[model samples]
Target: MPNQNDSDSNIHALLIGIDNYSSTSLFKSLEGAVRDINLVEAFLKNTLKLPTERIRRLIAPNREDTVLLVARSAHEPEPTYENIVKAFTELTEAAQPGEQIYIHYSGHGGRATTIYSDLKGEGQSDEGIVPMDIGQPDGRYLRDVELATLLKRMTDKGLVVTVILDSCHSGGTTRGDYAIRSSGETDTAIRPRESLVGSREELINNWRSLTEGIHRTAWIPVSRDYVVLAACRPTESAYEYSVNGKERHGALTYWMLDTLNTLPGTLTYKALHDRVGAKIQSKFPSQLPMLLGEGDRAIFGTNRISTHYTVTVLQVNASQQRVKLNAGLANGLDSGTRFAIFPFNTADFANKQKQVAIVEVTDIEASSATARVLAEVEGGIGVKGQIEPGAPALLLAAPTDLVRRVRFHDQKQLGEAENELPTQALVDQQKEALDAVRQALAGNGWVMEVQPGEEGHYQVALGKNGEYEICIGMPIKNLNPPLMFRDAAAPREVVQRLVHLTKYQSVQELDNPASELMDALEFILLDQNKQPFPNPSNITLKHGTKAYLRVKNTASQALNVAVLDLEPTWQISQIPLRGNNAAFYELAPQETADIPLRFTAPEGAAYQQAKEMLKLFATRGAADFRWLRLPPLDHVIEKQHEATRGIQSAFGKLLEAVGTEPNAAPVMTRAAVYEPDPNADWVTKQIQVTIVPESLLPD
Candidate 1:
């Protein structure tokens, strides 16, 4: 959208093709020369819709032009070095302003080396194409000066000409810096490389003398108006490929036509070359295309008159917004392709707010498809990677439907043992946790479903948090049930605090203009006035700035939650607070906890950047999930860490909890009685914080 087109109106083309050359200097004949010209000519006539008389060709066997019905003029000459030059001069002289000229050459080409002469100059000799009817040792060297001079003359007439040479060329332009090695070499450039009869240095000088107003040392063709698209880089070979059974094509020519015809709209010359180059690399990995002269010129003097979207809005509703898009299974735009509605018309792209409304496609039709507007806010959040949720990631297997919802369940505890917690008490704790989380994440198009008593697409489990294999969160997962039921202020305050936190989360929307913040923690940033910041991409704060972090639980069940700080060096330690009583806290279901952050945004060269990470983890049942290898419960004394225990320690005296034993006997471990559960759902996510760049800071 940030570009424009500048190309001519009228077109004039001179195409040359040679399958067989008479000179021994040509070395070998090409099988696809004529075929390549035929395909290229057809494309110009059909796809470009160019008039036939404006396009002329000179090929071997002296045949009449089939693409143009008009008979050839007496002035039209054969594709000899002399005739090619004459036709080129005529076009340049006659072409008026706003006209485009095309010169396409497909035939024998080679690097000229003077092996027969005793005078050996530098090995750096340029390449040339072999013209017909030359039997002498000198043959016909189509020097770069002739091409460069005529091209300059053409452009002087205010004509935008493009030259596509499908023949061999050496010591020209390069694709640059990328490392590439010759996969292998093939002498398929119509003509084979061979030494000539004269000295290389003298031949280059003689050709340079014919061109005026151009300065260069090398014998390579140079042009500014005549944008040149060479077959390959200076070091590579251009190949002819056999498609299907027998029909052949010059690989570069085939892809060039294929891309131009398939792309829906006109592109700048640079864009077209990029597409063609990519296609050529896919088919022949080693062959790199060369681009010389102007890259920003419009392709064939055509422009996309107006902006177009493959899909358009059809209808809008409270529940969902429907869109009609031409992209389908064939176009390869599958479900989940996001659509956006900007605050202002796209024509004023710079003035519009980024993504005022966003949607994810849910269904497809034959030619058009439908998508659901997932979330919408006034100013809206920037698309994924900025503030919005990115595409969902599925691990292990793909979901049945592309769009999936959240599912919740309390962790299933299997056996019985130790001084266990009551089933009712634990279940009540989990219910409270789930209720809190459910309220916090209310309006972001989240679809919540009760866990299937069986396996399904639902992710994010509510079991004791930090189960090692999944995600970990805050503390208070394991405590005496008596404390929760007590009248103490600390115990009652936890519930009230959770309720207030949920209120904040419930009202939070991504579009609020005041929201802009980042801190190394899984929490929301609230300013001194207690309003949420906008844009989580970067955070800025000065000396007196007051900020608060609201860390919320992801699961429905209560878990022992711990907040630890991870330094840039990967060392882990608890984030010490002056008033917090314990190393970890009992995080109630969906409870939102607050941590006040105090610091100044680093300034000047002394300390330009600073980063800190707070990791939240929760584990149910156990005093500590032994596998974590963290320090002992910091609030308690007697300190050697304990061994990992099983479900016996997690569940109390409810034998019916496992099953109503029909034998009236508690379920016992038996090798034959295998109640096998292969997998369970859990969740994990990452949060990052970055400092605003100095240049982007507020004035």
Candidate 2:
């Protein structure tokens, strides 16, 4: 782990928190923003032992509230548009090379019409933080473009920066008991004179110069010098809730502080993010924290990478031996899922000695679960004392009945005549290959040999020489060409291909008919002119024609959405916002997003019609569905590993279970057990479209 003490002098911070606004009707006063900054300041001074002079504070406190514990300093300036800009300028000019800067903001985020449409590329709106002076003559938002420009100035000077935003870009209304941290959408446009630093023309020219050579349609420019820890997705709301049953605080800020206090000076930003996300989702299932840019870097140091996913132990009942976890059906927990309890600070679960106990899920709710302790280690090495709240429960295993059934076809089944039989040695080789494959799959929990009377999901037929052909069923008549392997293919290689096929099948078969989100989401296919296609289920478009997909969220809650393109060549890839570096497309309640689509025939084929499927996935909380992506069958078989972030280990293990290869050690952190959250109420909707040659069009 990197030592923070060695670089304490090089660290500086700027904390901005706003709870009051000039336009009260437009932006409601928050109860937690002022307190958030106070807590952060306390951490820096008391915990990190940083000098007071190294930290700068700007705040807008509610004047009528006397219950706020932390008294605002008179010297601290309000977080108005001008003061905020001046602070950024001062920090950039004063900070030395190689120093670290931490910027934290807790306020309302808003969206408005973009002032420079040409510079914004395809986006017509700009998202920004609403300053305290907004609604006044000179009041305006500090837009994302302007913020990126400011951060670039700091990074260009060789300084490492980290930004924490406890606000969201969309969603305005409160949900249940939580108050949203958003100012809603605005039609007010920002003028060129509103540039933070330079004149309008200079800022535009500088922004254009900075974005030169980069993808022009990107909503926000990508940068590696800094990382942003956002409270929620762009489509969702950031809430201020009573975290401790007393005072309110931004959910992200509270959980983040809790993680830091428990495991201070020992985590990278990525690890911190994972821990914080788990905790926040436990209470606010609708909010998912986002980590953008250089997530692998150390908290305040230059570079590092590691992550671990675990549910928090919210409570323990000694008499009943039942512990409640901060995860439930919404987090993908089931009745039989098991976990190994570890200390909150345990970074590596590979160390078996650090385990405290083993537990199994007994009951589940929408956002929480109850588990019973099955066994306690004789001695807890890492975490002393008994199990308590906030302990990390690493996934041990999940009980699942999902299996891949395969039927192997003999030469007769392939329609070969007996007189064409090869030499006796060739028959022996074929038998040897079948036995090798069966043996390799024997221990796999996910793959099973089809019984005599049982149906199989896949049929594998051995070729005349030594090649193999795999398809969905026995005949393989009209379906796309069978996934073929060359002669002399190794049994292990063949098994890996089967594993990939299993993954492809599993993703396609994913469904949640009982989910409320299923009805909340609507997927529409559009033609060249952006009009809805008449027959969406049986769509046909000329090759290379302009197409579009519009996703609308009609539910009261926000959703994190993504579009996966299942190509005719049997490859699955994410389509929407591709190459734009967006984490996922967020659709606010009753909001819609449009994604452009283009279809073309396979290479070297002049006139052909191919079928393609588009799958849209939406969840109340954030879920990484990138695990569903697979390379085309014709493409070379390269080993692809899922990201080690959230439920990746769970997904990886599913693939690993049906293979003969030894389990690979995690890259930086131990593998997390995969628990599919049904409570996230995830839903998938797919559309099939047929692409035809342009010459086939009727005059």
Best by TM-score: 2
Please, what are the lDDT tens digits per residue for candidate 2 over residues 117-160?
A: 77775557877788898877667888877776788889989988
Model 1 spans with C-alpha error above 4 angstroms: 1-9, 61-76, 113-124, 134-138, 170-223, 302-699
Q: lDDT of all predictions, in order shown?
A: 0.43, 0.66
Local accuracy of candidate 1 as per-residue lDDT tens digits, 1-699 = 112133223778888876555454334445566677778778777766667777778765323334331333456566666666667767777778767788787765555543312322444343455565433444555645345555656666788778887765442221222211111222222222232322455444544543222222122443444567777655455666665446556776777776666554445554455445544544454455565555555567633222211132323343434433322322223466555544211233333344445656677532233566555434554232221111111111111233234444445343243222345455445545444445543432223343557433333223322121111122223221322322334323333323222222221111112211111124556665656777654655544344555566555664444444332222223432211212234455676665555433333342244343444433332121111122221122221111111000110000000112123567577568754221111111223344434564579
Candidate 1: residue 473 Cα off by (Å): 32
TM-scores of all candidate predictions against the true structure:
0.38, 0.63
